[model samples]
Target: MTLDIVRLLELTGWRAFDVDDRGRVLAGSDESGSMQLVELADGERTDLTALPGAVTGRYLPGERAVVVQHDSDGDERAQLSLLRLDRTGPAELADLEPLVDDPKHVHRLLDVLPGRIVYATNRRNGVDFDVVIRSARSTEEHVLYDGGGLVGEVAVSPDSRYAALTVPAAPALSDQLLLADTMPETRADALRELTDRRAAARHLHLDWLPDASGLIVTSDFGSDRTRIELLEPRSGRRHPLVTSDSCDLSGSLSPDGATLLVQANDDGATRLALHDARTGAHRLDVEPPTDGWCGHPMPAPVWSPDSRFVALSFSGPTAPGDVLLVEAATGRCHPLTFSAAQLTGEDPVEPTAHRIPARDGESIPCFRYAPHEPDSRTAGSAVVIIHGGPESQSVRAFSPIVQALAARGHTVLVPNVRGSTGYGKRWYSADDTRDRLESVADLADLHAWLPTIGVDPDRVALWGGSYGGYMVLAGLAFQSGRWAAGVDIVGISSLESFLRNTAGYRRAHREREYGSLTEDADFLRAASPLNRVSAIAAPLFVIHGANDPRVPLSEAEQVVAAVRDNDLECELHVYQDEGHGLAKRRNRLDAYPKALDFLARHLSG
Candidate 1:
């Protein structure tokens, strides 16, 4: 059965920001260019079109007002607007200008402090973004940090006094963490340079202490093991917190700033441990469920608002993710209730794990999702969803998109291919430089493995965004006959051009991931989908944010032009005010339907 385009779109929860506090609920809805503020109070619902492009809504602690991040046309550009709502209804509190000038670039409100709001803006210029702190009421704006090498993590202290930013240099060199007073130009650089000479050292994780006096940072100091260090921000005095021999250390402090949680592998099984926040003394060890499918315990321990209860999402090799809420003091966990009926209206589909052997006999892990009913005709058409962060992994989770696709009767396989994290440093490092072809080969192998697993080979399609989008085009061009259709969103077509033209902050880190474009010309050209576009056989749907700083719209344009030149079926949809990913609900709603229509027209049998 062909999927109902309209029904599928409806199934997609295109939600905007909604805040409920003190029995009053304010929701942002799509109403032309302006957002409709739906106020629910005393069983009466009143819709007010007060703000434009309302993306998120937050209720201030004491003010009883709602601040929303909104844009005029529901495009990429968004501004924070304060709204005062009471018995007299909703009124505009403040009309604040956007921190960044580029409407197409991505801007995000980092955190709301005592008197100010911190925001970060990423432009096509590079990875290093402009950090701005603005007054909640006045036009007073302060540019804290700019023109730094690609910034990774930015965090503001709970006291609203200190701000920390991590900057990555070369892979072997130590990264710099900058700590500054939230109010002024009192930015002090804390360089965590390695004492030992290493060629590829990089800062992996960073966290600021609650006291705002120090920070805990994890770094790869020319070894497989990650070293954790606690450093005083003002004195620059560093102390070794923990060091492992084989497994990497990954975790952070609890929200209340009382306990530090750490995750490390013990005999191939990931273990979770809690440590004393101040002295780094081992406090508690929580044993995760031992099941064949349960591979390792994730580091994510969701802290409650008060930090008394810790919620966790755990999964293993064969096990689906199970949400558990644990008492912080006792470490006793209880299963949390997640209504699958409300989200998918059915029990969530659990992934079937398989280890697909790579070209060199190296086993690559993958998860396949198909309709629970084997007799269902919607099973044959498959969408091979590639994940972003060629460096990231596809973990077990309640993904709305993946579940929605499965509900529509299509089989989905998410491959952890090459360059994905979670396996080990060696597995991740293998895909670096020119080894991207192996990642491409891994996709073809999965396509070939589909029929053996009772899936239709001919009705297969490819889809992904960001790095995954690049994989979509790669699969089409290299493994041409395998996929029936392809959807590439903000994917790179030309690696060389992408490296040269990408925003500044991102370009600084490109050398470690893809290698320098100047030094590895041949390898980059071979990796580019644009260079091999003549080999494409499948119909293509390319989507991109026109203002994307990472993989610019040029990548999409070049590939679309090349595919059209070859007379291959291709369509390009560019959101003028979007970046890397679609922010507006309307754009997302519009893009997915068009993509579904394209895939159904080509791949559905």
Candidate 2:
């Protein structure tokens, strides 16, 4: 039976953001066509914000209101607004009390206390993000740390006396920790650097200890994998709370400060456990109903104020995303949101993990999804989907697009090439800076290895968004004959133009991964797919958000124009209301079906 692409894409997933003391959950759900903020309590759901674009929020300390962060279209310059729980129904844009509404600069709400809220903003100079502490009641605000670089994470102490911040040290691979005095008026020396820049490693998830004695930090300072550490900011003493030899461990201290929730990422699967916060002793192992990926890069598990329960979102190959609540004492997990119940079918197809040997003797880890039902039209056809974030890994999570492709009888392969995180520190940094093209070579290696899996190389099509989109164009241009068609979405055409025209705040950070324009302009131009547009022989389809701050709309425009000048079949679809990717369902319904049609036309001989 052929699955309706529209129905498959419409299946909703939920994400838990914050859980209050009374166990009221602040979450994001797409049940209403677009992702909107909703408060879940006592088996009832109340829509909190019906504003434009997807909304994410955290509950205020009192649970009477929420701090909602919303952006226009898909433009990620999110503005902060306060929405009270006392509303009779779903609150509209007019009902939200604007907290920070500067459309020109980006404002990220970090942490909230009883009387104040702390956020990182580039309002000062529009390039550097300064940690700003603002009064929740008034307009008074002051910069807590104006040092430099992108502020990655921020946490305010329970007593509101101190603040902790983490900034990127080696871009995606490592971070430097900084501790600042919140009450700087009384002290001459305010900010202190806890980690040395020379020995920088990945340091993040800043959860301050309840008593302000130290912090439960997640860092891979002296090891290959990340572990939880108890760091005394004042004395600079460190103690390991969680350790793993093969997998990277991420942990969060419970609100009561008595327990620690630790999650280990072994390849793509997630293993969650609990520990004694003070002694680092193992307590209980949390077992979800199915094997799935959880924690980090996603919203971290949020603990209830009383520390009796922890709420987190979980997803797997067969499971769409749902918020889960785990009791701390018994380790019993219950699903708060059953998003899969709405879908009408057997479970989505599960992917099998495979290791394909590359030409350089390196093994590429990939997941393959076979068709649920075979179709003659797409027989021997395969889609090689690349993930965005050359730094991110394609984990075992529910993807409507991946499912939709398989339902149409196309073999889908998702590979974690070099530079994709979750394997180890060395693997992620393998394609950094000048070594960028090395990751793209992994695509070529995958193409050559396709015959062994019964997938015809001549029928293979490249598909991806963002950085993955760049890989699609690169594979089609550099290895033109290897692929039949390409679909690029908000992807960069020229690394030189991407670095030069990208938002100011993003340039310095992105430079750490992709080479710097000032020094590596020549190398960037040589590596860009647009530089070798004449070499591309495959038909191409491009989709882009006009307001994309990361990969500008000009990228899609220039590449499509150049490819068409070669008398090639290249089509471009621009969504004026979208940013980096399509957020609205209406745009997705039109864009994806068209892209699939393009693939069908090119893939069928």
Candidate 3:
């Protein structure tokens, strides 16, 4: 059965952020049309904030108010606002009291306590972020530490004495932990570096121990795979808490300080288990309804105040999205929300995992979504969907676009080329810096393997957004004859220009992965798809957000202009209200359907 592209795009999902003491969940949902902050309580959802883009929030101590983090359109310059729950009825947008409303700089909420809220901001200078602790009720705020890079994670000590900060290490794809004295009198003695700043490893601060003597951390310091570790900040002592032989592991300590919800990323699928927080001993394995993705977008598996149950968002091939409450002791699971109604009769396709052989003998992990009943008109046609981040992995999560394409009889192949995470550190960093093009080469290998899976080699199109978009263009330009058509969304066409035009704070971080602009100018230019646009053999559809801070709209304009200059079919759609992506539902409903139409017309032989 063919699914309506517009309706598929409109199907929404829920992500649980924080659960209050009263068993109320503060979540981000699109049940109200657009992604908004809503309160889930007593079998009903109360809208907290409404808008086009998704809003994240945390419940204040007493459940009387919430701290909301929202961005304008998709600009990603998030601002923090407080919404009081002392009203008799549902709250409106005007009810939000801005705590930090600066549109120019980015303000991210880290944690919320009784009377204070901690956040990271690039307000001082646009490039470096300073961790700040501000009073929840007043304008009193203090700069806790000025960690010259992005703060990846932060966990306040149990006794509220120190704040463990995760900052980017000197090298790319690595992070270090810094312990800050939250109440220190002298700025000189306020910050103490716990992890080695020069180490080529990544460390994430999950939560503090109940005694405040140590911290729960996930680090890949000595191993290629990340593992749970307990580190003492005072005496510089640390030990492994949890270890996995083949997969990376991470977990969160419960509020009662007894159990740890351990999650293992085994080749893109999650293995949920409960472990002893203190001894790191294996306890019970909590199985979800299906073998799918869980705790995505982070800040999930939230333990209830009494520590009886844990709540996390789950999404599988058939499940659109729902919140699952798992009993800690028995490992029983129950769904708090259901999204199956969104697709009344449609049976979403489940992907089969495969390791396709690459040219270099390296195996590229991929997920293939085959159509249940193939449409003869589009038979043998396939779409290769590339994931962005190059660091992000394409797990078994529900993707409406992928399902819609499959329902339309288009075989969709999602590959985690070379640099995708979840597999290991070596895999993610394999294509970094000077080795960037090696990843694009993986695309060529993927195309060559298309015919082996019954897909027509001449009818496969490339589809991706962001870094994935860059791969789509690179596949067409670098290996022009391999791909039939391409759909690029907010992609980087010119690596040189992208490095030069990207947001100031992001440029330095991105340069670490894409190579230095000043030193590697020649390499950047030679590798850019824009420079070789003349070689592109496929028709192109370029979609971009006008306010995108990362790639910028110029990336789209230049490529489209270049493609059109060659007298090739290049269509461009620029959304003025969006920034990095199609975060808003309405924009997605319009763009994705049109994109599918473009694919249908070009792929239908």
Candidate 4:
């Protein structure tokens, strides 16, 4: 599945924030960098927004409209808009209207019901999010509950009488639930402490069973990885349903609420399980076509309006992310779109999932891609692609760049370093604050381990975005001689500056992982890669989104400037219309080519 650079780029597509009520896939195709929304049924795509940043939208539950999420210049403060599509109309943008267009606030549409929407926004005071019930037809809105902490992830009951909110238990990064009554007679302001922080669940996912008996929630209450439980809204007692050694979460509930889809991260790849909602019985287990793919964050498996099929998007080593419709009854999967309009050539060179031993004797898991087309040499170069989130895992997802590099004779190693998710809580929190460099050492260890696996040591390169970008800088600084080059994408240079400069709303959550500036200023600076620029002995390539609020543009600016002052070869690219990463295809088309050329020039095995 090694596609040509441009062809590989063109073939990658992902499911949008939407799967029409009919379950017909409306995806963001990769042909254009702007993320054009394509109706996968017919391969027709239409631009939904004018912005260049990333775009994710959901088709309103029962309406002929969609609610699109976008932010200006890559700032985390996003704007929401409603586009009531008119297939009969002549123009695409004709029926669009401003839904929530505030500059200082971040608006997230949690759930859309028959005639209303459950939304969370920091517009209340620009600090913490407040859950609100807004009329789908009018501007009428009512504050359901105002919690001091992060009042996000609003899940509305089927009858539209109740809403569930996830409030962060800060410092620990765990979360609890807040139940709000949204019925006409019931007091909207009356909120109940649905769950407590004493028994914390790091990831709280909620979904109302069809009859609204209570909620089907996935929590880490009594298990290391998350487990599915049925929470009785009245008694506030939970009945355990599905528990596993791997990370598991509740997926969509059937219309009648009988079948509940559950996705679990068994090792690095995902396994799909279907449970009987009423009995808490595991009825069936279904894995996607690909053995390893991402199912946690975005484009999760969605159930059809009929509840007979579950639509899921996944990416493997050679395959770009593809959408599959699974038949719930028969356990059969049918491809909606193979993460694109078409996937050309033979099966992609599937990656081998293996564990590399770490210095601390812990096992670090990774997906290794050996190039299908290697150079005419006994040994070839290697590249380690790091994932962001520090809370995120680098599964065997379809990444065009990774596949392209492998095709170009470079072995791509995507490691799930210590701090990454899917490995359980202890491993995920292993790289907190001062211990962050240990995660970089995990990469260095992978670099050192490459020789044993037949990769040339001197030609290895480091590549990552955001926190992973920070890893790039950390590798270049702390392990100067270990790499041939480094490619950093929107990485942080200073933890202290990032904490202070990031949007006011996101600082607290970030501090829970990275050290807090108020307490760890010196340690933060010492840990910052920009402070150790003199030790970076490799050619560096930096990419950033000017509107990136998490790692501000200044983070990239300072590093590029400082690295240039060291009299080394440092190439910096800043996209004005992009943020954090290249959301717009035009920006990616320009940026990635430079990346390929840079890797080729520096990684000469």
Q: Against the true structure, what is every candidate's RMSD?
A: 6.3, 1.8, 1.8, 3.0
lDDT of 4 by residue, 99-181 (tens): 77787788887777666667788887777788877776789888887766666477878777778888776535467787788
Give all candidates' CA lDDT scores.
Answer: 0.66, 0.86, 0.85, 0.75
**Candidate with the larger lDDT of 2 and 3:** 2
TM-score of 2: 0.97
Q: Tens-digit lDDT track for model 2 on 1-605?
A: 34557876777878999888777888889877688988788999887777778888887786588888888988889888888888788888899888888998899999887766788898888889999887767888878898888899998888877888988775556788988897776556788889886664888788988898999998888887889999998899999988989998898888779999998886687888889999999999886754454423256888988898888987776566788888899787778888667664564788888998998899998999998777898978999999999888898888888888888889999999998988878788888888888999999999999999888889999999999999999998899799999999999999999999999999988987888888888999999999999999999999999999999999999999999999999999999999999999889999999998899898875
Q: How close is candidate 1 to the true structure, as a TM-score?
A: 0.74
lDDT by residue (448-548, candidate 3, tens digit) is 89989999999999999999999999999999888889999999999999999999999977887888988999999989999999999899999999989
Lowest-sum lDDT 10-residue window in model 3: 290-299
Among all windows of ten consecutive residues in candidate 1, which has the lowest summed lDDT? 12-21
TM-scores, all models, native as reference: 0.74, 0.97, 0.97, 0.92
**Model 3 segments beyond 4 Å from truth?**
88-90, 290-299
In the range 1-605, model 1's lDDT, one tens digit per residue, is 22244333333211223222233444443333334555544545565445434455545434656556655443445556665555364444244333334555656666555556777776535245677777776778877667556555667777766667766645422355666565554234422232322344445556667676767777555466665777677676777677687777766666567777777744234667777777778888765544233344343444543556555545442233344455668666553322222334345577777788766788877878876654244557888998898877787644555656776678888888887766656666677777778888888888878888777899999999999998999998888788899999899898889998886556777766787877888899988888989999888998998777778889999899999998988999999867777756567778887887687677555
Cα error, residue 544 of model 2, in Å, equals 0.4
Which candidate should be chosen as best, given lDDT against the real structure? 2
